[model samples]
Each structure stands twice: as structure tokens, then as C-alpha cells.
Target chain A: MTDPLPTGATIGILGGGQLGRMLSVAAARLGLRTHIYEPGANPPAADVAHAVTTADYTDTDALRAFAQSVDLVTYEFENIPTAALDTVEAIVPIHPNRRALGTSQDRLTEKTFLQELGLTVAPFADVTDAAALEAAIAQIGTPAILKTRRFGYDGKGQARLTSPDDAASALDSLAGAPAVLEGFVSFTAEISVIAARNPQGDIACYDPGENVHRDGILHTTTVPANIPARLRTDAVLLAARILNALDYVGVMGVELFVTPQGLIVNEIAPRVHNSGHWTQNGCTVDQFEQHIRAIAGWPLGDGSRHTDITMENLIGDDMDRVPDLAKDPKCALHLYGKADTKPGRKMGHVNRVTG
Target chain B: MTDPLPTGATIGILGGGQLGRMLSVAAARLGLRTHIYEPGANPPAADVAHAVTTADYTDTDALRAFAQSVDLVTYEFENIPTAALDTVEAIVPIHPNRRALGTSQDRLTEKTFLQELGLTVAPFADVTDAAALEAAIAQIGTPAILKTRRFGYDGKGQARLTSPDDAASALDSLAGAPAVLEGFVSFTAEISVIAARNPQGDIACYDPGENVHRDGILHTTTVPANIPARLRTDAVLLAARILNALDYVGVMGVELFVTPQGLIVNEIAPRVHNSGHWTQNGCTVDQFEQHIRAIAGWPLGDGSRHTDITMENLIGDDMDRVPDLAKDPKCALHLYGKADTKPGRKMGHVNRVTG
Candidate 1:
């Protein structure tokens, strides 16, 4: 087993989005440095990261050099190419392990994994072709969603099946890609539990936060989610069950649907989750730092929060409100320092705390 | 007056120590960037700053180039040379203006300024020479301190006199430097008020934090200082009075001694101070961000503390306890990432929060 990373050790991060930017800040707080490997120029994480290697993921030499420089590797996104992971894994260890990444990278695998653990998930079936799609639709029924098995995010690469007749259109929307047909489950709220586990099998979960989406993008996440305390406990326990099952070694975002019958697992992110951003202002140790602590082999911090918070994302043109928002005494801004604000782009987030 | 700096603006910081390192993070938090200029190699701020210029302060060309690249100039330390300030000021405005900086740069001047502002301060006299030192010693009386007029910090450049007979040795310890003799005031505690002001004259003051020194250096600072609530108001008022009087455009640390005869102003810092570190864990917006807001023309944040915090400096060997401290859930580590730990060198600090 690897020893806890010492102060000044550099951790290699595979993406340079806002998540990686925040993780860089958290690592800096712990006296550990980070080298961000991203293909884009002037990534949001570059301003705060210790080093940046702007090379495409397919560059084997660049990936090898990046891996050689850092003590270990962890990624902000789960869709990394398997060959790229193989290249870096040959040189250094990658936390949240490849198995966790593999499970989360594909919707079908994620649902099957949860079902195998005796957890409730929307009934889902795999479809590799037209015939297979029709058979899967027959089993999962109408009002289902056809989603790409891999490489999907932010409600992308998915189509809705309103009835048996819409099934053909939904399958065509997938464009011949491997797909998962998830049957509709009526739900009242979508809550996420940001959970973490260390290499030694210790698990910690932040309180569940209810999320509100706008235009298929997360708009806000409110802590102490509007759910019965019992379900809150259920959400946390379910998240822990998944973490332990995967033997996860970093923070994971477990998104669940709160239905009248029971909580149903929707999806999981094998990295610091957007819904957990409120912890930055509400908790003693935030999720980014928790992930850092876990992957560095340090003890997972007590995931206890001291304040109630509502975190709102400043997507695209929402940056205009920053002038007025900066004046809000209760707001703590965490802008991503993105140079431009394209539509649906996550520019920043603000956590408003209440006493 | 300059407009509030826009998103993506770059701030130039002088003295790339832990304070500057933190300011960089805060600027990044606000969607701004920072360029750190320091004479040292691989300064602690280098890892997080967007840019670093390693050049001597007297390297006027480099200084001018650094200033021209940034929207405004701010500093981590107050002992900046007048020539250096002039160079930067000629290109970009410097915050916490020269008046405030000049007043706090010298011990004699600082004490005189405080007294002139109708604030309580220790009885003091200036000594330009050894003969003058003896004369000043007689006026201030025995059991006083002989401190250099300029460039003293962390309890350096000072000698204490227990009695009149020790005057010659105390003066000798200063080696004929211009000095100040101040009669000691026995106080129940030492406290600091971290206050901020923007160009528009708006002011905000954090709650007073009691300080303890060990081996002449700040050891710990506890918020909601162990003092009467009335005195806490007095501390905040005194800090605001000073900031207003100077028209200070950034955060200033006001250290005061709580004596029976009200509070005596010990000294002032024209930049963020170590004693205010607890705000990182206790307040909605920390001192670093507040300072950045002030200098950038943004409104000052609400300096309300939601949690009580105790901030302790990790000096040299104190870093040995970091592993155990990291395991303590309430402790928020802020290591400076210094390469080597020398005796008395501040490697970092930890802020412990309480419910």
C-alpha cells in the first residue's frame, strides 16, 4: 500500500475544469502541489495549479511524463480513455480505482452494479441494435429515457421515450451507440450524497443536498435537503454502501431520486460532485479537501457541517449578477476564472450560508 | 476613483510569502488573477500565483513591468522601500495608500500617530543616538523597551530594559540604530482587530481575537477574545477609527493591549495580519478576500463570525504535529509549502473551529 503523500508531493490531475481548479486549491491548502494535464490551452485550473501540461490525452509520451512527475493520478471526469488510463496506470497509481471509473463511465454498468448490491435503481436494460432496443423497451416500458452507455454528461447524449411509438425515435437519437433504457420512476426530488472513502476502507458522507436543475444543468443545491430525517439517513447509508462496494478511494457523488415508494439511485460521479459545493462554506472540511485527503492516503476528515447553505451556479450569462452578488454579505463566491462564458458553461458558484 | 476591478483582472502583489499566497487563492476565488513579485527564489506564493517575477525590489525595470501588467498593486508586507512603491505607484495604484504604509513603517511614527488620533498608547520617546537613548530612557522610565524605528517584525529588532541600570546595554543591543523607548503597560491580554475599508470609505471590522506570543513570535489567536463585550466594541471602534483616519483602502491589522486604562494601541499592519487567520474558518469572508475586495474597489464583506476559531502558527518543528492535526476534523490546515523548516520560521497555520 502507498504511504500517505507527504507535504510538497505533487498529485497529477487529469482534467482542468472547475472541479480540477477547486481540487487544486484544496491540495494547496494541504501543502500538496498539483500538475494539471489538460489538452486545452489556458484551462480554468491553470491559474492555481502548480504545473500544467497542455497535451492531448492520446499523447503517450506526454501522459507518461505527467504520470512520472506526480506521486499519484486522479481525474476530475470519468470519461477518460481506457488506453490513456492504461498508459498512466503503468507509471503511477490512480485513485478511485479503474473499477470505480469503469462502473461510473457507463450507465448500464452503474445500474447493474447498484442492483447487484440490492439497491433500488430504475429498471434498465441494454440495447446494442434496433432489435435489442425494441426488446429492452418491451421490458422497461414507455416513458423511459434512452441514454448512451458511455461518454454522456450534463443531460447530453440522451433521448426521452414518451410511449412505445417514440421508442424508434429514441433509439435513432442514440445514433447506433450502445444504450441503456431506464424506465420512468416518478420522483419528488433529486438529492445527492457526496461520499468519500480512503484506501483503508473508511467512509464519510456529507449530508444529502437537494438539487434543482434549470435547462438540464444544475442550478442550485440546498443542504439539509427537504426530506424526512429518516430518508436523509437512508440516502447517506445507501451512498456508503456503494462506496464500500466499490472500495472507492476518493469522493463520489451519488445522485438519487426521492420517490414515494423509496429512494432510487440515478447516477454516480466518481469525483467531487457539483451538489457538494455548498460544503465549502458550510463545513469545516470541504469535499475537495476530503477527496484530496482520501487519495493522498490521509485519514478522511469528519464530514460534519456547521451551517445550512444554498449553493447556486453562475452559468454563462449569470456572470452579470456578480456585481450585485459581490455585495451580498452572506454570499461566498467561487468563480472558476473561465475566460469566456459560453451558454451552459459553469463559470462559478456561490454558497450562501445561514446562521 | 478607479472602477472595481472586472472579472479576470490581474492584481500585482509584493512580497510572495504566505500572505501573498493566500491572497492569490482569494483572487482566484473571485475570478481574478494575481502576479507575485518577490526577490526570493521559489517563494511560497509561486505555486499558486498566476505569474511570478523573481527579481530584486530595486530592479526598477522589472518592477515597472510587473506593475504595468496588473490592474493594481497590493502588498503582503509593509516594509517595502519608498523607491519600490514609487515605481509601482507610477504605473498602477497601490492600495492601503502610502500615508497608511508610511505611518506603520516606523515604530516611533506608529505610536505617535495613534496618540494623535485620540487613542491610548504607551508613553514613548525617540532616540536618534546613544546619548538620545539615555535621555529618552529617563523620560519613558525604566522597565521599558528600546525598539528600532523601522523594519521590525515577529518581535525582532527590540531589547527590553528591566531597570534604569540596564539602559546602556539595551541601547547597545540596538547598535546605534534610530530607536523608540516605550514604557511598558501591564495588560490582561493582547488582542487584534482586523479591519477593512474600500475606496468609497465603507468599513468593516472583524471581532477581536486574543493573541498569545511564544519566544517573541505570535503563537495563537483566539476569536471572541476572552474580554468583556464592551471592550470588544472598543477594539472594533478603535480599528475603524484608524482606518477612517488614514482613508485606508484595504485591510489593516490593529493590535491593542487591554489595560485597566482602556485599550492601548500596540501597533498597526497595513496589510492582512497573522492574528486575523482565524477568520478563514470563523467568518463568512476571510481577511484575504476582504483585502482583495477593498483594493479592487469592491464593497467590503460582512465580517461576522459564525464559528469561534483558534488559529495557531506552525513554526518549524511544529510541522511535525501536522499528521495528527490533520486527523482532527475541526482543524483547517493552511500550509505555506515552504521547502525547508528552520527554527522560528512560520511554515503554516491551522484554524480550529468550534460549534
Candidate 2:
């Protein structure tokens, strides 16, 4: 078993967005300091992190310096550049390993890996060219999503095909990027399981949370999801299977589709997920802390929910309701210290304890 | 009514200790940035704060520059020098006001103020010299405590006078510094109420927590203190009265000695107190966030306890048990990233949720 990190050790985080911001706060709570590395100036995580390095990931010197300054490294996002990883890995250990990141980074790889584990996932086919896309669409049938194999988020870098006739235009919209065509599953509800695994191979999974999205962006996540008890148990087991398969160390968010058939895996986030925000107010040990503990080589904490919570994202103009939300005693508001609020921007979120 | 400060505003914190560290984390959660000001180098709060100014409180130029950079000023401790307050107040508004700090800085002033407000405080007499100490001892009788009037904490600068024969030596033990002789109160238990008040004159109080101390330092605080419903209501009202009298804006900890007759005011802290740390796990909005909201001119959040929580201080050698504690799912550990752990030094705390 790996020895746990001592207090006062620094953890280098690869992103400086809200996830990194929350992770930095969690690291501080555990007596660990965070050094945030991002190319953007005045990133949100810099406000809470112990240190920040503003340099491009491609800058080998900056990456090496950042790695040497910390005991371990973790990334807030899965799409970290391979070159950046190569530079940091030589100096410090990165948790959730490069394999987990590489597998989750590409749609084709993730689907193949899940299938190898005997997990239920939507039928998907790799489409590297227009000819490949045409053949994949014919086999997948109508009403499918063609998503880029990498760097796709918040409904970006994706195109929907309503019928076979629209396949040409849909493939053209992808701009010749390698893509995957996934057959749409008729799911009744969307849910996600936030799971963690320490280096010792101990695993813990929080209860599944029902998710609601608007315009392909997550709007809210409610815990004690209105699913059957068996489904909940299955959701957790499937998440644990993925963690064990990857030999993962850190928190992972596994999004699933609840259908007439069993739960179908949608995607996996190798870091703290937006759907897991409810755990902040509902669980004794939140997902952020769980991730920190796991990456630090500590025993996994209990991810059991103690309270029922509904987490609502305050995107863009939704900040106008902050004053009203602040007045509500049950709402715990978490706002990212972003200077400007643009449309569809996730400015913050509120976790309301319903019970 | 004061207009609420906009998001992304910077809050200046005076002391960079664990309280300041927690306050900085809370401020960031509300989309606010914290600039910590401390005379000590490498203070604990610097790890999480957006900015840190390491300069002496006596440095007028540094204090002015620090205050000018933030929208408002608040403090983690009450013993700030009068000159430091004057310099900072000239640049930006300081929350909880100067009078509140002035009243709580000295034992004599705090006792007098509480008594003036018709609260029950132990009988106290100012002792400036040996002659004054002798007279005060005669009036207060034996089994009283003699403490320095200012700059005393965690039972420091104190002597117990069990009998008349010890009075001369007890007076000399203080080394001729100004002091106060206070007759001890016989009480059944000790409790404290964490209260907050916004600039708009609105107030909120967390349920009183039963406090246990070891070596004159807080050892543990359990919420839903074993008190009668009537006494709980009385505690909240008494705390509100003190906040209103001071015209306080920010959180305050009011310690009370529960006697057979009623609750006697032991003392008051103008900032977040150790006894209020239980709220971090038990309440929707913790004392740190409540203080930030009050200072930012926002509405007070609900202070109702949803779960029973007992917060235990991890002092000095107590950190040795962290490895074992990390295995317990119910124990939420919070550690200050201090390099050295000395006896009586608060290294961190754990909030264990019982319900």
C-alpha cells in the first residue's frame, strides 16, 4: 500500500476553473496547499490556491518547475495535453494515472474499455472520415449523436442527426475531426454516481443523483434520485467496477442513463463532476474532499448522504437570483469568483437542503 | 440600509490565523476575494487567501495600502491595535465596528459593558497596583481569579487566589501589569451562542452549544446543548441584545455560564470563536460565512442545526491520531497547515456528526 502524504504537502492542480477552485479549498481543509497552473490570467482558482503559475501547458520549463514544487499532481479536467503530462510525470506522480485520462479523453476508447468490462453502454462506432461516418450512421440508424473523439464539452463539438438524409451535413459540421456515432438510448432519467478509489484499491461510491439539463448544460442535480433501490445499488456497483478496472486513484463521476433496460453508461469524468455538487451539503465527506483524500493516498471516506439536497447551477444571468437565494435559510450558495457573467456561464451553484 | 457589496469585491482580513483561513475560504465561496494582512511571515491564512500583506500593524503605510486595495475590512481577532484600526478605517469600512473590538479587548471594559446592558457578569474590580489588588481581593473574597486586563488569551496571564494568604503573591505574579479581579460564578454548565448581524439591522443566532474546556482552552463543543427549551430561547435573545447594543456587523461568540438561577455572561468574542466551529458541519451556513455575509451587507442565513455535531480540537500531539481519524467516515477533519506543533497549539479540529 502507498503511504499517505503528510500534512503541508503541496498538490499541483492542472486547471484553474471552478472545479480547481473547489479542489483548492478542499486541499486547504486537509492541511494541504494547492498550486494552480493555468494559461489564463486571473483564473478563479488563483483566488483560493496557495500559489498559481500563469503559463501555457506547452511551456516545458513552467510545467517542470510547477511539478518540482509539489509532492503530487492532479488535473481538474480530463483533456490535459499529452505533452504537458509527459513533462510533469517525470518530476511528480499524477493520480488517476495517464491511462484513465487517455481512456476518458476519447469517446471511442472509453466505449471500448467499458464494453471490455461487460458494462452496458450505447452502441457506438468510430468515424474517422466521411465514408466511415456514412457507414456508421447506416448501422446506428436515425436520431444519433456524432461527437468528436476528444475535447468536447457542454454540447460543443457535437452534431445531432435526425435522419439518414442529414448524415452528410452532420459529418461536415464536425470539421473533419475524428468522431464517434452513438445510438441514442431511450432513457427515462439521467443519473450519475460519484465514486472514489484510494491507491490501496479501497472504493466508495455516493448515492446516485438524478440530473436535469437545459440546452445540454446541467441545470440541477437532486440526491435520493427517484429510482428503484436495485437501480441505485447497480449504479454504485458499475461505478466501482470502472474504478477497479482503471486502477483509478481519485474521485470519478460516472453518468448513466436509466432505461427500461438496465442502466447504460453515458460517460465518465476522471475528476470531480458538476452532478456531485449535491454531496457538498448532503454528505459528511464531499466529493472534492474525497478526491483530495484519494489522490493523497489516504483511505477513502464514506460517501453516504446524510441529507436530501437539490443543487441548482447559477449560470450566466441566473446570478440575479443570488440575493433572493441568500435570503433563503436552506440554500448554501457557492459562487465562483468570476469577474464577468456571460450567457450560459456557470457563475456559481446553490445546494438547497430539502430535508 | 447599506447596499450589498457586489460580487468579486475584495475583503481585507486583519489576522492570518486559522480563523482567517476559514474566513478566506468562506469569502471565496460567495464569489468574494480575501486579502489577508498579518505581521507574521508565512501565516496559516496565506495558503488560501487571494493576497497576503506581511507587515507590522504599526506600519501605517503598509496598513493603508492593504486597506485601499480591498472594498471592506474585517478581522479574525479582536486585539487589533488602536492605531492599526485608525489607519485601516481611514481607507475602508471595518465591520463589527470599532466599539465592539474596543469593548472586547479588555476584561474590565468587556465586563463593564455587559453589566451596563443589564446582563449578569461576575463581579469585577480594576487592579492597577498592589494596593488596588489587595482592596479588590477583600471585596471580591477568596476563590476568585485575577487576570490581565488586556492581551490575554487561553488562560494566559492569570492566577487563582484560593485564599486571602495567596493574594499578595498572586498580585506580584502579574509583574505589575494592569489587571482585573473577578469573583468566579458557580455554574452547572458552560454554553455559547454564535450570533451574526448584518448592516441592515437584521440578526440571526445559532443554537447554543455546550462547551468543554481543557487547560483553559476549548476542548469540544457539542450542538443542541443539553439545555431546556426556555433557556435556549433566552440564550438567543441575550445574544441578540448584545449584538444590537454594539450595533455589530459580523459574527460574535457569546459564552454563557448556566447557573441554577439563570445564564451568566462569561465573556464575548467580537469575531468567530472556537466554540462556534461545530456549525461548520451542523448548520447550513457556518459562522465564518455568516460573518462574511454580515460584513458584506447580505442577509443572515439560517443557523438552525440539521444534524447533531461535536467539534473536538486537535491540539499539539493530538495530530498523531489523524491517521486513525482519517479512517473514520463520520469524522470530518480540518487541519491548519502549520509546520511545527507545540503543546497547547491548535493544530486543527474534527467535527463529528452524530445524527
Top-scoring candidate (TM-score): 2
Question: If candidate 2 were superposed on the true structure by all CA atoms, what would the RMSD be?
Answer: 0.8
Per DockQ, the best of the predicted structures is 2
Candidate 2 local lDDT, B157-273, one digit each (tens): 999999878888888889988999999889988999999999989999999999999999999999889989999999999999999999999999999999999999988999999
For model 1, residues B45-129, the per-residue Cα lDDT tens digits are 8888889999998999999999999999999999999999999999988998999999999888888889889998999998887
Q: For residues A19-119, write the lDDT of model 2, one tens digit per residue.
A: 99999999899999999999999999999999999999899999999999999999999889999999999999999899999999999999999999999
User: Model 1 over residues A105-160: C-alpha lDDT tens digits?
Assistant: 99998999999999999999988888887898889888888999999999999999
Candidate 2 lDDT score at position B75: 95
Candidate 2 global TM-score: 0.99
Looking at model 2, give its docking quality level. Answer: high
